[model samples]
Every structure is written in C-alpha cells, then in structure tokens.
Target: MTDRSDAHTATTPLAGRRVLVTGGTTGIGRAIAVLLASEGAKVFVCGRDAQHLDDALARIREVGEGDGITIDLAEEENVARLFEAATGYLGGLDIAVVNAARGAEGLTDMSEADLRYTIGSNFTAYLLSAQHAAKAMGAHGENATGQGDIVLIGSMSAYVLGKESTVYAGIKYGIQGFAIALRRELGKKGVRVSLVEPGLTGSDMVEGTSEEQAERIDKEEMLRAEDIAVGVHYLLTQPRRAVVQQVTISPRMQDEE
Candidate 1:
C-alpha cells in the first residue's frame, strides 16, 4: 500500500519542478499557486488583470520566488507571449495547471457577445494554454524521472444539471474531451495529462449566487479552493510509474439530484 502521509510531508516532493499556472491570480488558481510553491516548485502564474496579477505576484513572492505575467489567454499572440515569458523566467516547464475560466450568468438572457466572450475565455484559453505548455514541456524532454505532468482544472458542472449553465457546462465538457485525447497523445512522450473536477467550491464564481440559493447549495459542505489544491498536489506528486488520469472531488454531503 502506498503511504499517502509520506507523500505530502513538508520535505518538498516538488522541490525542483518548474511549474506554470494559468488564471493563477485569484480563486482556485491562486490557492493552487500557493500550495505548489509551499511544496517548493518554482511556480510561474499568469492572469489578464494587471492589478490582480500584481497582487498575486506579491503574495506568491511572500511564499517563494516565481514569475507572474499578465496576458489574455484568448489571444493567440498573448498565449505565445505567456509561454515565452515562462520559458525565460523559469528556464523550462515541468508542470502546468490550467485553472482559468469565466462563469457566464443567465444563459436564456445572455447575448451572443457574452456567449462568445465566455467560450473564448473559459474554453479556448485552456486549449491555447495547454498547447503552449505541451510544447514547452516537450522541449525540456522528460526529467531524470521521465515524467511531465499537466493538471487541467475542470468543473463538476460539466456533468451536473444547472440553470444558466449551458456555456459553462459545454466548455467544461470540451475540456474533459481534450484531456482524454491529450493524455493518449502525450502518454508515449512521458507527459501525463489529467483533469481535476471540483463541485461548487466557494470562490469568486459563486459570488453570483444568491445568499439563500448558495446556502441551500450548502456551500459550507462544498470543497474549498485549498481542497482542490491538495488534489492538484496529489496528482502531480505521483511516482513516474503511475498516473492519476482524473480526479473528481465533491463535498461529502453533496447529493446528485
């Protein structure tokens, strides 16, 4: 039996790993950045908002030294620039956490403009980031341990039924498909791709919910940002011989209806 306790002891299983996290300035992405840095990975994070990016960079620096960049992932050129920045700052990449996404409100009332922006930010951005991350990690070759890992943050909403979630679910489902296909393609190259799905976590995304509705959802019972961070750490820390292809985490009290 594998000892999970030893796996997360403070000795830093990620000591020398070079990592990049998209949407790393807030919410789940920010939590992930902090956790990865605590484990000693040299972490680079990016976001589109300059003020938030600066704040996140300052907080992350308090934890450890890592680079942060401001880029709109929906733009191909910006995506390319992000990769270049990470390469220059970190020298190379070993792990990538794709955690950026936007929540669209009111599907029935949403404009086409809203739909386009939502998909572009949530779905296209993830694909673009992954493409660049794969290229960067591929260039680095496998580490001495012969493993490269990518963790894509997905949503339980992809599979759950919800009002006004048409675009969000669609994009998340697309990410699931992308992860499976990417894993198949990269497996041979020693790059393991996986998805992390968390249910109704408390974050900026949930602020849109009404107090009554949010309480009924039992947000307290739902997974926290750091909870998902622990999952990310677990997925990346596995021995080279093993791969956790997908992880679905929900509140123990969460019931599917």
Candidate 2:
C-alpha cells in the first residue's frame, strides 16, 4: 500500500500563519481577527479608528500575536500603505480578509459628499485592497500552488435590495460579481477567493443601542457579529483542493423580502 500517512492533509492549519484583516477593529472584522489569533495565527489588522485598533490588537494579543494600524482605506494611497505595513509586520501574507466598509443612506437622503465617500470606501477600497493583496500573495507568478486565501466581506443587501439601501445594495452586488471573476482570475495562480455575506448581523453598522442589539439577538431576529466571524473562519480553514465560493449566513427568523 502507498504511504498515505506522509501525504499532505486536506485541512489548512492556521497555526503560525500570517493574516491580514482590514476593518478588523470593529464588528465582524474584529471578531474574525480575534478568532484567527486564538487559532494561533499571527494577525495584522487595520481600522479607521485608533481606539478600536488598540482594543482589537489588545484582544488578539491576549489570545495569540497581532499588530495593526489606523487608516481610512477609502484613499488609494492609504491602501497601498496598509499592504506595505501589513506585509512588513507579518513578513508575508497567507490570508487576507477585506472587510472595510461604511454603511450608506438612501440615495436621495445622502449628500454629495456622503455618496462619494460611500462608493469610495465600500467599493473602491475593496477593489484596491484586494488587488494589492493578490499581488502580495504572488498570484500569476511562477511556482504557485495554493498560494493564499482572500475573503471579501459582502452583505445580504445585495440580494435583499431593500428601499433606502440603493448604494449599499449596489456595492454589495458589485462585490458578488467581483468575487466570481476574481476566483477565476486567481484560481490558476493558486490564490483562493471567497465571499461571505451576512444577513442582519448585529454590529456597529446597525443603528441600535447595545441592549436593543442584544434583544434582537436573543429573539433570533439578528445574528451576532461572531456568527459572521464563524462563517469567515469556515472559508479560510477549508481544504486546499476546495474553495467555498460563497457563503450567505442569515438569521433564521429574519423576515425575507
């Protein structure tokens, strides 16, 4: 019989792996960073708020090892700097979670400035950051084999397409399409691309007091941010030969449109 014991295993271990999590100082992003750290991954995260960055890094350090910075990803130059800093800190990248985004109001209710910021931060940032992450992972380079992982954080807004969420839904729809194309573009180069869409998750993005959010979670009307984190973890920990192309996690009791 063949020496099957010496063969490579299907599961990708997280121990000592280098990870980059954008928008990781709050909500789903923060939860992902902490969970990866707990699993022995060396995490690097970024956020717009310095306080949140400190808090996240502290939590990660309490579990494993981590570092991070504060910067607004909407600016292209900042995105470049973020990758440079992240790779420098982690030595090299093995996984990247692109989760930085801002919620947008209704089109008619939004000011011109708000509209531009929403598009720039939510859509443009995701694109630019993913581009940099792919290059960092050596995608399209020779000798690539299971090079790395990229998980984009999308939203159920894409499918829901509810009123007052025009810009948000449009950006999420763009992300869904982008993930499909990106997986094909990078697959041959050994980079895996996946998307995780959360439905009605309780986070800073949602408008509610902590008590209200907790009540919603208790009622099963909304998902905890950690629920989305678990979905992200599932995508990252899969076997090398498989890629979970997309995962949509919705609250069981959430009324569907």
Candidate 3:
C-alpha cells in the first residue's frame, strides 16, 4: 500500500489541531490517530494495555506529537481522568474520537461481568468522555475556532444484522441514537457531533476469523481501517456551517442493505 502521511498532510485540513482518541492503540482508532497526527494534529490516545499503548505512542511519535495513557474505560475514574489528561497534553481539545469498545462473549448466556464490561467500555465510555470534551472545548473563549468536533465510531451492524453479534449491534444502535441527540444539544455551542459507522474492517476485531477469511476481507470483502479514518477526517474538517451527522462506509464488494 502507498504511504498516506505526506499525501494527507499536503491535502487535508487537520494541521495543528489537538485531538483525543480512545481505544486508539489498535484497529480503526489507531488508523485515525496516526493519520491525524501525520497531518499535524497533536494527538493523545488511550487503551487498556500499557504495552500496546507504548507501541502505539512509538509509532505516533515517529509521525507527529502524541502521547498515550493506559486506561480501562470501564472504570469511572479512568473515564473521568482521560479527557483531563488528554486536554492537558494537547493544551486544549479540538477533536474527540470515541472509538473504544469491547465485545461481550456471545450475545446469549453472557455473565454479569461480561455485560457490565461491554456496556461500560462500548456505550457509557463514549458518553462520559464526550461530556468532558464539551466542557474543555467551551473553555476555548469567544473567538474559538468553532467549539470543536466529536466523532463517534459506530458500526455497520447498527443497520445490518451480523449473526451472533446482536449485543454489539445493540450498543452501536444506541450509539447512533446518542449521536443524534448529542448533535441537537452540542450544535448550539458550535460543536458538531458526527458518527462514522464502519463495515467489516481488517483489525483485531476481524482477526478472529480464519486466515483465509481475513485475506479475503483485506483484499475484496471489507473496508480497511484507513478508509474509516477518512470518514472521520471528513466529519472533523468540513465547513463549520455544515453538520455531517453521520457517514457509513463499507467495502465496494459488500452488498448494500
């Protein structure tokens, strides 16, 4: 694949922006974080694993300014602290990408622990972080460059049925609803809320499949992480007057609903 760093820098509008991405150590969040950093955005990312956080930061630092913290979003304290730390590092907040989610092991027969963890990580985390984002951006003063942007990473499963993935789908469905409601409230403050729902993408989430299945998805069956990043960038960079409520992206080979 061709390197997108230089091309993205020369072409798009994310330079000098301060961004925070949750669950950004891998998968779609990683792609968005790295791409934004390469385009001159000071980014901060967080994940559950310290080792993965280190690895991601190394890659991000090679491209542009960035930092990472190991946070279990399910924990209330961590969720509260994340935005404050990220904003402190970036000096302020211009963009927040809500992309962290943990799947429950099978929809049926889930234990209480599985349900709590999944709900905390996938659903509640986004809401609490966005709340902090609103406060941070509001502090940007009267002449602030728009209040900022909140981009939620949803899933195509919100609209399409994925066998045995109903619990995950339900969380995404709630996210879509939350994103809509958020837009209604935040737009008055000059903050735009947008949702990017991605179809099957080649990431750790998709890695559970067989190798041949993964190859097919990478080559012809599904979208790539960078593709979803493109959608997120568009949402953040669009004219302040225009509010892009949501964008759904999928591989060309994936049949439409």
Give the clash count for each candidate.
0, 0, 0
Model 3, residue 105: C-alpha shift (Å): 3.5
Instruction: Put the candidates in TM-score order, highest first.
Output: 2, 3, 1
lDDT of 3 at 8: 43
**TM-score for all models, in order of appearance:** 0.86, 0.94, 0.88
Model 3 clashing residue pairs (backbone): none
Instruction: Compose the digit string of candidate 2's lDDT tens values, residues 1-257.
Output: 77775575567789988999999999999999999999999999999999999899989999999999999988759999999999999999999999999999889999998899899999999999888888888884455554899999999999997899999999999999999999998998889999999999888899999899999999999999889988888778888789999999999999978
Residue-level lDDT tens digits of model 3 in 41-139: 999999988888988899898999899898899987888789879988899998999999876555776888888889998998888888888888882
Cα deviation of 235 in candidate 2 (Å)?
1.8
Q: Give the number of colliding residue pairs in candidate 2.
A: 0
Please provide the root mean square deviation of candidate 3 (C-alpha atoms, Å): 5.3
Model number with the top lDDT: 2
Q: What are the clashing pairs of model 1?
A: none
Off-target runs (Cα >4 Å) in candidate 2 are 1-9, 140-146
lDDT of 3: 0.85
Query: After superposition, which runs of candidate 1 have C-alpha atoms over 4 Å from their true positions?
Result: 1-12, 139-147, 208-219
Candidate 2's displacement at residue 92, Å, is: 0.6
